[model samples]
Target chain A: MMTDYRLTSLAKSLPDTVPFVGPETQERARSRLFDARLGANENVFGPSPTAVRAMAETQHWMYGDPESFELREALADHNGITPDMIVVGEGIDALLGYLVRIMVAPGDAVVTSDGAYPTFNYHVAGYGGVLHKVPYRYDDHEDAVALFKRAAKVDAKLVYLANPDNPMGTALSGAEIVEALEYLPDGTLLVLDEAYLECATQNIALPLPLDDPRVIRLRTFSKAYGLAGARVGYAMGAPGLIRAFEKVRNHFGMNRAAQAGALAALEDQTWLRSVQARIAASRNRIAEIARKNGLRTLPSHTNFVTIDCGSGPEFAKAVLNEIVARGVFIRMPFVAPQNRCIRISCGRPAQLDILTEVIPLALRAAELR
Target chain B: MMTDYRLTSLAKSLPDTVPFVGPETQERARSRLFDARLGANENVFGPSPTAVRAMAETQHWMYGDPESFELREALADHNGITPDMIVVGEGIDALLGYLVRIMVAPGDAVVTSDGAYPTFNYHVAGYGGVLHKVPYRYDDHEDAVALFKRAAKVDAKLVYLANPDNPMGTALSGAEIVEALEYLPDGTLLVLDEAYLECATQNIALPLPLDDPRVIRLRTFSKAYGLAGARVGYAMGAPGLIRAFEKVRNHFGMNRAAQAGALAALEDQTWLRSVQARIAASRNRIAEIARKNGLRTLPSHTNFVTIDCGSGPEFAKAVLNEIVARGVFIRMPFVAPQNRCIRISCGRPAQLDILTEVIPLALRAAELR
Candidate 1:
């Protein structure tokens, strides 16, 4: 029950579970440092040196351009869109929350994958929207058609899909996604989260028409650009829909340091390419380690790899605990079947080397226990 | 007129006007440099030098500690409260927005001053809350009892009051606030915005019980701490109420650089005191400027001064525009009577010198025009 302050029934009904815990929280709880910090899929390669330098240089300003004119212009130039067609925010997390606030309301129907990013769902719940979740495909890819069908059936106001899915490390082809769009019911907006887009295989570009009124594509500096802490992201859509963000967004919400860092990171595409190369190598090393330990590694098109532990939830939990106990921080999916797999992120050579050495010991410990 | 998205009827109806346009936006529009940036009430002295150094040192991390453990622990120690009772976020603006999101829903009643901070009103409108605005007292104090009476009449769910208030630079003693608390009707939450608390006189502190479930105090690093660009702030209230933020807050929204900077800024209280001294000096200088121009200046408890331009809104607007054209940026209150007074922030000696030199010239130009 809520206090006498009179919170809405929806807020009073929502549980207090956080979307994701940072590795720092885990370290604090464990009272020791993780030997391999590969959780939360953060790019351990670090942000571009130039971006870091720029943030450092501009640390004295009160606030950045409320319009985010410079960063928006740069993003538009990079994406071949008009500056007015974009809005910059703290991160895609914040943008997701705002989009829900702009669109969904009490009793409105929203659709998403069953085990998708919980933060988006949290926003929907906060707005009192009813969520209809579709299960992932048996092969682990997001079932785009199923999502569209669900949205149509519920007359959903919004439908969320993360291409190059998380937790399972699977992806839907751009063409596959476009084909599903035909099934999208009228007046249903589609949210295409492309957070891991840059790190995915080059063939996955759907290039949703910018003029399409029903689609908004979210891209961020957090993942491949390695600037999650800076919290900068953007969404592209028809100018009309995008402008609605102005009606409610905190005009000066964009931190000056974040805008400077993101601009520099975007310009240094060379660093991004290098990080991609390193991430690819780290993924392979993880898969090799899993194979050596007699586990089945799911084929991945993103920075992280998920390996089937060849056991039940209890066994997978045991294996994960053993690794974490051994000072290797990693995570697993929260849902059934998917929870039977362990997820590891791409990092530097030293981090992967530690993971390579620890997986076998963890497996053996789990078996013995 | 919302597109296919199902916005709350209230959200669909909210007006798009924000509190103020950022100085950066003005700079972009004018395509020229403002010699004096006295707008936005930002400290021209910037943040503590120590904060600048700290942010520069830690700009490359992926994400900060999600729990904000160290900062909260330090803040709790400083405030004589437990860390669990504090919730840190991007800034007081973000915190106010979050508080509104949790407490107010479509058609929910909320109350504030007619000419109070527009940002809070903007948040209320965005969430579809019905806003009940009480006019400012003739003496320029926020009429606390009148606000309570209005809230009671409307059965308001939340009421906002900023002590050492913005725009007016006036304050109510803690005793006064606590006394007003008694008039707050049952089921009403009081939002005590103490953004300028540290800089206020000794009389501002009231030994009110923190466990009184009716009130939540908002604090920030934006004003006296001079880290507005960093976007770090916190809310102090009963643990039960504070815990509710976990239900919908962006779990990883706090910036790593900002966290580090705020921690260092908190640690260097000696530097903070020095900034306070400088602010006091600047405030006096602003008053002198007003006096020399034959304008009446209010007694200010915050970092800015409200100078009555001895004219109507049109004259105030003319002087303001003339100052802007003369390359000194400042602002005025949005409503009548209050609009007769232009607000000027405390700045460095150089910035103050510019304001001193420009006020007379701008007034003369306005008179001639």
Candidate 2:
């Protein structure tokens, strides 16, 4: 497919397909805007008012702190770690790509679940890392033990697992992950992507020590904080591992407004709590809609629900297309068995109304197809 | 020095340095804020009120157009080129890093001036590209013919030259560049970093045809548009080279506010022209000040002026430090010959007032030292 100038063999082998289509892209393709954007797992409730005010206040400033010193200090105070333990980036997507650049040299083995976040896989493939994908468990939670075993078998340098996994909205317990670590080989770094950590149930194993040499935890203002547009994400790990980012990371990469907005977002716990409540209400409404349609909704600890549509990928695709045609944006899994389920993000009441009204129609349309 | 973890050999060899120390970092280090900031060539006039309003308007939107569809289309209309010929990134810094990643395999040759923007050199080093630096010719503008000769000598895959070159505030004509392109090797890519293009006095170059494969031009909203905090920079080249970015780019990398702000900024050429006029006035004022102090000012096509201190790097450093100590922030060239000059950004009348008040005192202080 690449014709003119030759890219590195690794880049040449990468597929043009991306993990998820942005709603704006879909809107352009459909030639009509979505009436309800409950796809892509974004919080439609939006960022905190305080975050917005902070961003507005800082728009006049020249480039935010390159070291992100103030934000890092505030985050350190909030997360109970020294500033050296964290490295902020454009987003988890950017941070993950940078990590792969550091750890996964050409031909290095990388491990993840078969139905895991495809963007992580895309990055590994982009960097010429050999991917070893283990299959998901019955509940759609990544099988951590299996991932570790595969990493050991392949002598992998990196393994990625997103807690409260995407597409399925399923999560593994901290004990289970800790148990699986026993099987992990030395020198392998575990990239625990907790993008939705805030929305998950309480006591879900957070505040991982900064000195943990083998584990790097990623968190973002994008999801539960309703700041997906800000593009602020941070990684926490041992100081040496974190500092390695300076070698290749864009020192001035962060947006000034994002730094201001994210710092304010982190400080506004009351607003976050309010969003959590709304998310809980929205999730329940989605579950009720699924039940009414004779579908089983997976118990979601995140900001979205995955409902078994009682069909295969073909039927799921039909339902998605039908809903999408009616200006209701939704998505589904990419692989077999999992593809039987469709995913919907938690939005406000108006968005839920659209889904509740359209689900039966979409299901009927799928059956007719 | 990297005790807890072993970085790749390439990362180890890369120096721990950045092109410039940002004002925010300096403020932290000094433990006292500067009264005036006229450094790093950022627009002190601030972004267009329209851009700020637009960003504030869209601050809550999750994920902008990943394709950057609307913005790209609008820019295409503005530039009289197809949208396929453009790719936007965090800033020109990130774009340079990405371009280097694609072109330079380990030990590949990359060419730039000895005293060119060090960030380009930093990117080349980080990517394990062997840097081939040609000295600046006696004339202030980059010697494109000499650069081409060096590129040919080293079989350089990439050649970087910032028109309206920084630190010296010099520029080459569009015709001179086009003439030099004839000598560019078939496989080599010319990275024409025109970060200050809008501020340059010369007749600016239009986006070349989509089939012009030998050169890729970089532009940013950070300069004349006064949106340095926005972190929006774009590259224009043949569609084939531009599309290759998808293979390794962080797909959802852009900030939504930045996308909205840059779109608004690009549309407001009236504001841009006003800024250009202000910058011109400030440059003239700076040159007059230099003459009054028996210093020589170079011909400037950019927003900043580099005044020769009629001494060496040490003397210039003293002057720069004195300026900083007296609450004005300015910089000088990092390498010799050029280091005999100090770079000062065009600021509002008040900022220039501080510079005018401080420079003489600073020079006297340096002489006494």
* Cα lDDT, all candidates: 0.85, 0.85
Which numbered prediction scores highest in DockQ against the true structure?
Answer: 1
Distance from true position, residue A105, model 2, in Å? 0.6
What TM-score does chain B alone reach in each candidate, compared with the true chain B?
A: 0.96, 0.96
Give the clashing residue pairs of candidate 1, or none. A90-A231, B90-B231
**What lDDT tens digits, residue by residue, belong to model 1 across residues B259-289?**
9899989998998888888889999999999
User: In model 1, which runs have C-alpha deviations exceeding 4 angstroms?
Assistant: B1-6
lDDT per residue for candidate 2 within B184-247, as digits (tens), equals 8867788899998888886756335644788888999889988888888899888888888887
DockQ of each: 0.62, 0.59
The per-residue C-alpha lDDT of model 2 at residue A235 equals 93
Q: Which regions in candidate 2 have their CA more than 4 angstroms from the true location? A: A1-3, A206-208, B1-6, B59-61, B204-211
Q: Each model's TM-score?
A: 0.97, 0.98
Per-residue lDDT of model 2, residues A1-369, tens digit only:
225564555566766666667888888887888999888888988888999999988855387678888889998999888999999999899999888887777888999988788889888888888999888887777899999999899988898888878867888888788888999888788899999888886646644565689889998999988888889999988888888888778888899999999999999999999999999899999999999899999888899999888878888888889988888988875587688888899989988988989999989998998
